[model samples]
Target: MIEVSDPNEIAALARDPNLDRRFETPTCPVNWLLLKRSLKVLSFRGHRFPTMMPRDDAQRTSNQQDLWNLLGEKVASIKTGSDELEPLADWVRGIGPDVQLGILVQQLLGQLFSSKFMATEASWDAAKVLVAAPRLNNLPLMMWWFVSGKVRRAKRLLAGMVNEDLSAVNAIGIAVHNVVKSLRQMRVLYANVQTRSGLSAEAAAEQCLFAPASVYRQATAAGQLGDCPYSRHSLFVLSIGEAARHAEGRSLVFMEDSWSRCPANLWIPAMLQGVWNRASVFSQFHDEKLSG
Candidate 1:
């Protein structure tokens, strides 16, 4: 596992032939590879189109710019109050203009994993997918699999690294899964601390490692939720970049953490900048993009 953060470094690793690949598997009878591929497709759709995976690309560039502009405004909303910080996840939710986009994204992903709903070898219990908050959306389906251990399989995001050299890189770090657990832990740790500093969670984390007791307390108090004050920011940024890369058919950023740079560190600005490049010219628009 080569620890790497630089895009150039990761690109170098991508050229390596010895690199292995892996992904989390569904715990039930669902086909893991199929599910992964399906999610990848949905991710591509969500990132590529803002209007519930629209087929019209007449304003691709303008549309993307609009989305980003909207995103920027929403991000700025966080700094509007005296808090100067806001939950990243909630902020991302407030950006998109399309309300059905969430449903479309989930349904598409769910349908991709549809074999599980059948009586085939991949069949699962119907009770597992009640039409409720989670199952009503694929979020519940995904959560069920998380506990079942389907998505826990670790995959190497960087192409160039090997297992023996995971410790040598300065830009590398492990990605901590169990996001909610980590955030809740942070809540307990910083239940009664002040946060006026604008340093990001990443900064506070580094400070916590070797700072004095006063600094440790300050760092821990960075936020009441998330892994740090900017955990949501990290999540949003990482998800966008990962979805874009994965959508491009390069699954480099969606894997579990290793001794080296967490997959999130890899720089893929295209994910953010290419917000509205018209959809592929060769491909016809898709209307039946997803089915739950």
Candidate 2:
């Protein structure tokens, strides 16, 4: 078990069998038209994202174009029962890593929030003004540029997200309610994440996914959580801290574990090679885990 930490190594790990790449649930449902109209009422029109996503007729909560549908088409086209990996690799390889990261980051943010890519708000309070749920969906948009390949574009998008007065009081519990284990440990775990490693956005996103799985797991245990976090019929507490341990790459081994770490969350880093890809970014850390 190689704990990958090297950036180049991490990028290479994207193609690894252990990295799960899929979004198993639906997003929080919001009326795209109504949300847009509400933005005007709240004067968020100026802060709006320019990217336009095509909505699925069935998924009313979604505002971004579904990629697994587009990308999955490629996956489905592969001949089943064939051991050939090149076809799948070819599909992933066809897309630019930066573009792949951009699509993924925008999709992740869109899933957690809605309608567009990254944007800004007046403050944490102002940030949640009209959104439906709240969670730390705004982590590491700055680093998304390198993996996403559109540095200037990523930078411009990140500008709107920076709230000078952002805080836990105003930041949590509104707009983007999907949670991450990192948020609970932010003051300690994530605040000092840099000391442990370079702290890439890809790593941040990858490590945070296991928390959602724990949330879903507990919900299953008590029979209290939603059908799924991404489901419209799903209803439950959308908070973090319940899951502190990594899912230990279980998602890579089973599609069911994909829910634990949303594919949107995993895909960006996987493409960026900071997680389960073969490049083995955390080789140092992974070695200890396997040996210890």
Candidate 3:
């Protein structure tokens, strides 16, 4: 892992798979975006990269423009299965360090959340969001980003529901009742997830964490009650903890002592229900697990 301070050094390391932590301390957001975009181009085709390193600033500027042009073309043609989507998807997933795609995704997600995209009422604006979304669908990196967004959205929706008036509360209660009913059906499917083909829940959960699989497995497998500060079914629980910390605008490590570490409450029942709903649908529709 290279802890590069120079923008040029960062760009140089983008092509190499040896470095695990590509973007180091005090992350330069613009440099990170360019590196991610450049890596995607390299993954799509090795020969697309410049054959020689530019000697002068002018040449470097031209090369940077070339890279940007390539990214524009790729992002523009990134339609779903319209000939460019699969290749782009493959390129993003195939990039080295396995974190480049995640970086690109989080860059886009940050833009989506901070920019006016989420609040856009125009259908064409929403359509543009969908196009970018489908390009990374079903990929592990994309799933992590999506799950992060889903968890955030679920919390926001839950909070709004609880904060509303009586009529709104009644409506929210009805929605919750239906979700509970759906979850009962899904729990049956979770029981068979290990035996079924395609992606397993454990595998999905593994991808959600920022830690090693062994660490996660050890934590979940131990299942020692009150052994740690908090109880967690799996390592992925840490993601929820991190997300909650971010939402509260505090350090994630600090919350570990309270809500994250051995907190006795499974207060995320609605979020869990949403996961079950999606899991069951994917298994039944894509994995053919529910067929007679």
Full-model lDDT for every candidate: 0.25, 0.29, 0.29
Error of 3 at 102 (Å): 1.0
Assess candidate 1 and give its TM-score to the true structure: 0.24
lDDT of 3 by residue, 1-292 (tens): 1122222222222222322212122224543443443233222113212211222235434644553453344332221122312222232223233323222222222221133212122322222232233234345765664566632243233224234221222222222232223233333345555533344434432222221011011121223222223122222112322333233322221223221121101111222323433444444675565463
Most accurate candidate by TM-score: 2
Candidate 1's residue-wise lDDT over 203-233, tens digit each? 3322222100000000111122212232111
Runs in model 2 lying further than 4 Å from the true structure: 1-65, 69-118, 123-126, 130-205, 208-241, 244-265, 271-292
TM-score order of candidates, best first?
2, 1, 3
Model 1 bad stretches (over 4 Å): 1-8, 11-36, 39-64, 82-185, 192-292
Q: Lowest-lDDT window of 10 residues in candidate 3? A: 211-220
What's each prediction's TM-score?
0.24, 0.27, 0.19
List model 2 lDDT by residue over 76-110, tens digit each: 22222122322222222232332233223223333
Provide the lowest-lDDT 10-residue window in model 2. 216-225
Model 3 stretches astray by more than 4 angstroms: 1-100, 116-254, 258-280, 289-292
